[model samples]
Target: MTESSALPGLPRRLLADPEMISACASRDFARIFQLAKRRGGFHSSRIARTCELTPSRVGEVISGKRKITNMTVIERIADGLRIPGHLLGLASRDWERAEIPTQPQPNAAMRRLAELQNAHTTVPSRELDDILAIAAGSKVTPTVLRSLQVSIEDYWRRDDEHGGEALRPAVIGQLRYVTGILQDTADPNYRRSLHGIAAELARLTGWTYFDARQYSTARTYFTESLRLAREIDDRTFIADVLACLSLQATYQDRAKDAVTLARAAQDSARLDGGTPRLMAMLSIREAFGHASAHNREATHSAINEAVHHFEHVNPEDHDPTWVQYFDRTKLTVDTGTALGQLGDAAAAEPLIAEALQAEPTTNIRARAFHTFWLARTQLQCSKVELACATATEALDLATIVESPRVLTHLREFRQLLGSHRTIPAAVELVARISETAN
Candidate 1:
């Protein structure tokens, strides 16, 4: 049930797949485990320690005793192995569904019809009409027809990803068609749909770069997305882009830039009578700025305001699918971290507990931040045993995601732990943190 012998160097996509496939398509557990182990840079001892698994258990997986059937387990393995989860088929998302039919081959006439249908509308409807007219008399070859269909599909795919290349001019040219349609259309519903597509496409371009940690490219994409959002008069999306810009600023430690962007977002939302959600988001940005400056009073005030706004904001009020993700619990989690940084563990503990209890499924990065703060709070309170455990958990998650922000927080945690070197457990955890740092 293994293709490892037949295909020694299969692409990473195939190496990472966990789903059941057609006959003759299967994975070699032993080969995959070895590959993961080699890529992860871990010996047996290190692997066992990080995964909290027994040495025997790790050996069994490597020897193919245990099948890699569990998604969580596979993710854990990838993390421990230091392999990019996406490259290893441990991606947290599914690929886009293809539009073309997936089945047995069609007959010659059916294939011809498909090719004609795939022809770009930008080629001129009249030109297509003329081609169809000519095709009505002459027979087309299946080879030529299939090639045309593939070219058409490729154009659309490229358009979806990067607005298409010059060879795919018809696809990019559709942007003009969209704009023209918007101008002539009077139906609000159609305009809304068109604007929504533009926003999604624009955001996807930015997300590709942002997720890859290419900040400069992401900034440009976000700026372009914001411009399109303005053209469509979508205030929510406009605010979202502003929030993203502020996020970039925060990541770069430009607190003043973040504050300026957040204030601009607040002004725009105010014109529309600032909803609870928008106000909470703006306040969150302000909190970030205050926290960066270590201004306890200002940070607390902004965080408290955010919590107040979040409590009243109905998740149903937002039309943007992403906006509904915000909640009071998450805002409080952030507030707790800010409070802890400002040396208010007494004020921070309760909020951290509430956030932990909420069991939020969204925003792992934010949760990681909260966990880092909780660890700091425990350390400051002389609870070395508990602090070390919390710090380890935060470090593990941060390591899995390769987040610089989380690593920075870990550095801070290490500094705190280093000051209290008497506890053996704390010292061991600090060693682990140091190993990861190197």
Candidate 2:
């Protein structure tokens, strides 16, 4: 197996042996157990503990006297062994926590991200044959494509309500399945429709990774989605992908790149005669980029432009399905977030609070994000007590959701509270964050 294909924390020598990966991918626990015991120098007792199997069972499996068929047990073995999720026909694992070298590794996250750029995996010939047979027997229909679209939308709603970590695996599996179907479908029209849906799936997967704070993986998906969108001349999707990229760049502190990408998205949308609402979304991203760069004049200008476009959104305008959620509440929250980033807390607090109050209960992620921003604004205004209270509320909401992005923000808030640790509320908030992190 190539270094890129190796799962995190496994011995290099074991990965160098190609059979190891193949064995794991095929769920040949017997061979895996034997190889790991012999070649990998792992003790039978250690393997048993990791796999949650008795030592006798491990020996029996290795000796070909027993078979492991439980899916839950299989998952535990895969996770405990740090096996790559995709290799086992599962969703991608949390690459972020994968153990690597103890040395100071620079851009380690980016390296891990690069490994996932390609969706290709080498399955056993038997598995490949089964997939081909399934593909050949299945017929592609408009109804099927529509249903896939609806499923993607449902997953998006769930991500908003629950969190990325909760839904990432399921969505990744869906994307993989859709991509397989796309490869098998021979009809030209069906292929085109599948490509569009596949692009959306890729975009969704990328956003989920982004919320999980896996930026590099997110970038890879967005890039692939852009390529797929371009294949079908999907100008709207292209703009959306670019806008998503801009958001990722902004979070990474690549302010200039963020602005450039956001502007490119806006220009693409305009050239394609995109919906005003779509343009508004892109413009808001641009404003955010400017705010991050501390370019107050540019930030306000872009914000105004976004507002203008949003206000003129035609109720009958042909908008993309993805932008259906871009409404007044979203605009208010995004604008407030940008302002808060610019240190205009006095102006941002009320707007953010109002947006949070108006936000639907179903959008747990958005509420957590908005609450964090509101707390940040309060901190900026030196309202420490109120900030602590609001941050506690954000933390409470954050605990129920699985957003790494929200967790990161909460950590930043915790850091801010560090200076005011003498205050009782700040001290309590710090302890709460620490407990939650553990």
Candidate 3:
């Protein structure tokens, strides 16, 4: 049976579907094609024909071999499939205005949600624009919940590899939609799961903004994350959000607030019977907070505690999904980063090198960040030549990665190099960096 109507495009039922809606939100057309086939009675040939794509290209997308990114191509897909332009983060299509009267009128929430999703938008880019839009979801279902969960994971993975600057639109857009549905939803069997979904989305939206160094907007989302977590009484994720806030505080140079937030997170984790990796991640954050305060003794103590907790982590422990990044590699690099802040280059260098060696090539952002830290540690030990060389590599990566925060770190490091500015190696690195500004 056709889920759509007489038009040669997709049906209204598919557009309203949680699974398809999630796919469209992220522009995962392979999933979209698959869903259309499975749920909307549309085949690859049909999608290809309507979207102005080749059958072979459609096949590659379905098999995960390609992604569609051109704005024009995306618009064609939106129009050909009769999808609303707002859903794809595009301006309204001519066809949308021509949509027949039999087609349901889209409300303000849908239109405004589309407005905020535009990366070039004049909109304020807030997380929630219309409360009624959030309340406009269909009855919650397991399938709907599962589809959103996967998208969230994908967003984090992408952020890890390339940073979050480009992901803001999709992340924030889905968050607004999901959070609205969550508040208005009262499902007895799936209510808590929905809250978990909303909490994580809010946390991720906050994180993308954090990665961009927009602290004010980031705090609003993090605050929302905490509230949603509290609704579900999920202490693990609650602690996670607190740790994130603590890290943000460290960045903002609020050492006292940083330490206080870290400790509060730790206390909450303990009450939840924390996992080893969770405790390890929090401990390092605590260590960083102390280093910011210039408390040498407390810094080392927390470092020791972090290492101790990490040693106890086992694959079977079933750590919360959020702490999956806290593997030995992460623990090692983070420990090195915290120690570097304390100016203990001798203790920090080898650990950081090990982390860089094991770091996956796909995560360019992490490599760039850790490479810069390595240079700083080298500088701390007074290895001016080696530090300059390593810093040059960091500059290369920083140029390509989409993080302003990494560039900011590079600026701070340049100030630290003022005394060495006259050195030959330092001079060349400085000139190279200066060229980027030009």
Candidate 4:
């Protein structure tokens, strides 16, 4: 079946409409299917054949009886229909025609082709020119830089509260805008300030991407931020970025890299005269890395150093805004988590529980993460019933937040629960997770 034969009676014009493209990009598959069948005169069987879906599944999707959550399948559908990749959050397809089809009578086909061209090509160039002009025309001021920093801090807090998935796109957009401003600014002092803001923004973006499980993109932003921080000789910022990288490494199970990065962050913080609290935070990260590496002695030493430094933290000492979230509760949690990672669940449990109880409601993602860890600790200690209950709570909270980090933890817990599937609670939890995934 040829493409044209499969799509008999379907107007090529409607397929290329900007609105239709937008719908596809947004995953409105049901609406797109309906429009194809109703207005374009295409059939379910044809769409299924072209998109490599079963005809029954296509009908189910069109009737809203099923949801299409697989990105690969969505991409396949977009390709099959010749949907502009950019409209579906993908790169422009190579086969896209450079010129729109010219028709004597301005028909739907011509209009559709024009819309696709505008969306894929013209719009981006125009937006870039507008951004550059605005940036070039604006004078870089201390006030402007300060405002941008404030906005970055605000978004960071929002990301913590709502989860990275909820705010990543907006943060990325802001980062691009800031990058433009940095490119256009000429004043050295203003440039330095803007660079600092941009570095922080980059770190924030990296952190969000990490939470969202986009490791490569996260590393790219982290590397860029670290470079910017070094160029400005901002040691505190440098240490923070290093710590961010360390955390990512830890999550990715690169124990040696995690340890090295965390140690570098600690050393950098010390040399840069970072506040005691900041040093403490770095030390905790080092402890985590050591724990992951199964170096119990080093882990214990690092945790002790962190506690000592934290205890010495002066209330009056100036600290970076980024380190504001590191308090006693966070310290306790990190120490406990490190212990748990090192197979010392008995010691880790009470500390984690205490930390969870003290955790603020605003940090929903953190709460869920802590809950998952607590559940893991429980399972490690052979507290199956309690672990299942705690895991269920974590799963419920995971549903509330959009953080992939939390989901990752839940997935780990799911693997652990697989052994106890005979338990009713574990069975139910497994079912719940499967449903959530689908």
Candidate 5:
């Protein structure tokens, strides 16, 4: 908070400058270096040495031709220049703790923390002062944890209304940051919250990949999320990850695996004392698995159980944040989708139609997904013109959504309409679909 001095290198007056603070807040490293050079005595070569970067890199940064993103370099810049940790979203540095009795010396815990961090992180930093800061348990304030939660929740909201294709970079970056901190963090108490935050972020990252239809990448993140959740013994979150895996399995047509995963999710949720909404969510996945496997009896059994659970759901019941989305609209949509997969075109059409009609207009991603399902049911029922019209509506939303999952289902519906190609509406729909591809 005070003026920057020799080791924490920038001058006090320069640090207090409004432009300096704004640039640091936005991480405009080029602007930061330019200001440092002009206001502080930091020429490019000196800046390069201070921040553990090359002179050429420093020049590029000052010229606004490149931006610094690597955590290691950012940490060095913060430490070498003694920037306030809060300005850069880092832990308080050793220099900031000058008045306190110095436990800043590298002890066994700090060394071990550094080694583990180096082994796990691709962007490993040379500065271990923050490791000492972690050893002192100075990073990851409650506010920081809460901020992480808010960020993940915001990402979820955006993914719901819009799609995850545009958000994958930010979500994955956040996951990696939390993961790295978790790997080096020494305090058990801090580790617990870190792991919980990491789990949620990993799960969110997986969901983004799932929406992008990158099954392998999504599975990797899902598995990482499950591992973190288990480490924290967060049964509610554990069940959510398993449900995600189950849904991904169903998407990949691995029906048996989906069934197994859904059952695992149900078991985990039961351990946490399952809420009706939670049960209903997992049960629908089980139904999806059964339907995908062509097991009509099992599929209907699961669907019936889902409906029963939904009927028992109390809106006031305290369900997990993830389970809050499984309201009546979701239940109806899933049931219809499962029924359609089970080859009951007549039964599926009405439920999907009702769901499509009931869904909020602003929930473009969900609307796109549901509209395609409704279109598929219409096609199966030989309502060719109606199906084409429905598909076109979904196509419009899909363009806005950019979700591979929505487009994937739309492609399947198009293929199903192949038999009716001679129909004028079908021909027109094919041309429209072609336009989207272009």
Candidate 6:
């Protein structure tokens, strides 16, 4: 392959950068993830929501089981990392020609796809682009983008917050419709264009199953989402999926799996100089796995790494859309809890307190974890009354999110408080949580 005789559209320096290789190897995912976490501010839970990719999928790509062929997906990942297409040595039209396999059994894939798409159907990209152009060209106050985000967030959260079974089918229908559309589009670029939607649908589907406690189906959707993300070459989305997978692994007591997935997620982040949001999430998730395994040193290191990334974020440098859940307060909360788990009650107390006091509502998820940790810390400090209060708060927050993750914390907190049976409130809270757990 002479330089002059190279692929017509390929860039001269495409193969020059070792970063792409590093990306494929997943070697630098942790650093890249840190960058993304800082840039996008994504938390582990919100990474999928904002990035429109399954967190578990991040690992699949790093493990090289998932191959990336779509230029658009690569571009999207590059875009999320704020890297130029030319820098990745991609030709202008390569993304358009990138091959992605539609399901061999189109009928089944389409039916499944259509069910997913119809649930969250939106105006075509052409229409969206036109509106965006107008907004860019003129002073448009009523931008549709903001409206779309809010609406989508609401739609995304609806079923999870309320156990409404009726809406599930409708949502699934939307997913199937979108999947069908991707499968039906004749244009080669169709898969690339559909990548974002596909990732989003897969994520929503996975979340639905996760919330419903259907772990197996949730894992399947997450895996599918990860495959599509790689076909599209979107590493950040891939990282998001890996995070989800890690969460599931942790929830299921698959600590080693969680650690392995977290490492992969970190690699994906490193490959593209990933968003700061993803970085913090990967670190925090690593902390979770380490904590679960009782690896205090590793947990502390992960927490510290997460904190370092959180301090260096610049919102203006980000992709201007998605990512944006990571922040200092959240990192502090995570760090504090991790420390608490390592038995550093003194160090953990201030971090959790500060996090809880700062933007409490925004910290609902953080508080859930922190409250549980705080309870433990209080117990360690022999503040039984404070421990009981913290335990109750944790349980209440867990009830609100219907998270088994949080429920597990509630159970642990209950057991801790149960040792001090003299307190009626503690006894009652423990009983309530025990019943809920059963």
Model 5: per-residue lDDT, tens digit, 120-175?
A: 85555633324433443436678877877776776687678668865565566566
lDDT per residue (tens digit) for residues 55-88 in model 4: 9999898776677778789777766666667656
lDDT of 2: 0.81
Name the top lDDT candidate.
3
lDDT of 2 by residue, 42-146 (tens): 678877766567899888988766767687887767765666676566776665255554454369785554455444644335443245336445588888888
RMSD of each: 14.1, 14.1, 7.1, 10.7, 11.9, 20.4
What lDDT does model 6 reach?
A: 0.62
Worst 10 residues of 3 by lDDT: 125-134
Off by over 4 Å in 2: 1-138
For candidate 6, lDDT tens digit of each residue in 1-438? 332122232122332222232222222333334334444353433433332446675545444344444655555554333333443445443334443344343588677656666677653554222332333342212242243234335445444333323234434544554565556455555456556666766776786677566789999999988988898788887887898888778778888898899989899877878866668778898888887788888888988788777666777656314355556777777778767866788888888888888844634545676778888888889888888887878777776554565676777777677568878877777788888865
Q: In angstroms, give how far residue 80 of model 4 lies from its true place.
A: 35
How many residue pairs clash per model? 2, 0, 3, 0, 0, 67
Q: On residues 31-106, what C-alpha lDDT tens digit does candidate 1 reach at each position?
A: 4556445653456666666545678887887774554556666555444443343333445322113224655357
Residue range 219-263, candidate 3, lDDT tens digits? 999999999999878888999999999999989999899999999
Candidate 5: C-alpha lDDT: 0.81
| TM-score for predicted model 5 compared with the true structure | 0.69
In angstroms, the error of model 3 at 262 is 0.7
Badly placed stretches (over 4 Å) of model 1 are: 1-194, 200-213, 315-319, 361-363
Q: Give RMSD (Å) of candidate 4 vs. truth.
A: 10.7
- Residue 166, candidate 6: C-alpha displacement in angstroms: 7.8
How does candidate 4 score on lDDT?
A: 0.80
Please, what is the whole-model Cα lDDT of each candidate in the order they appear? 0.60, 0.81, 0.83, 0.80, 0.81, 0.62
Question: How many times do residue backbones clash in model 4?
Answer: 0
Model 3 stretches with alpha carbons more than 4 Å out:
1-137, 423-425, 435-438
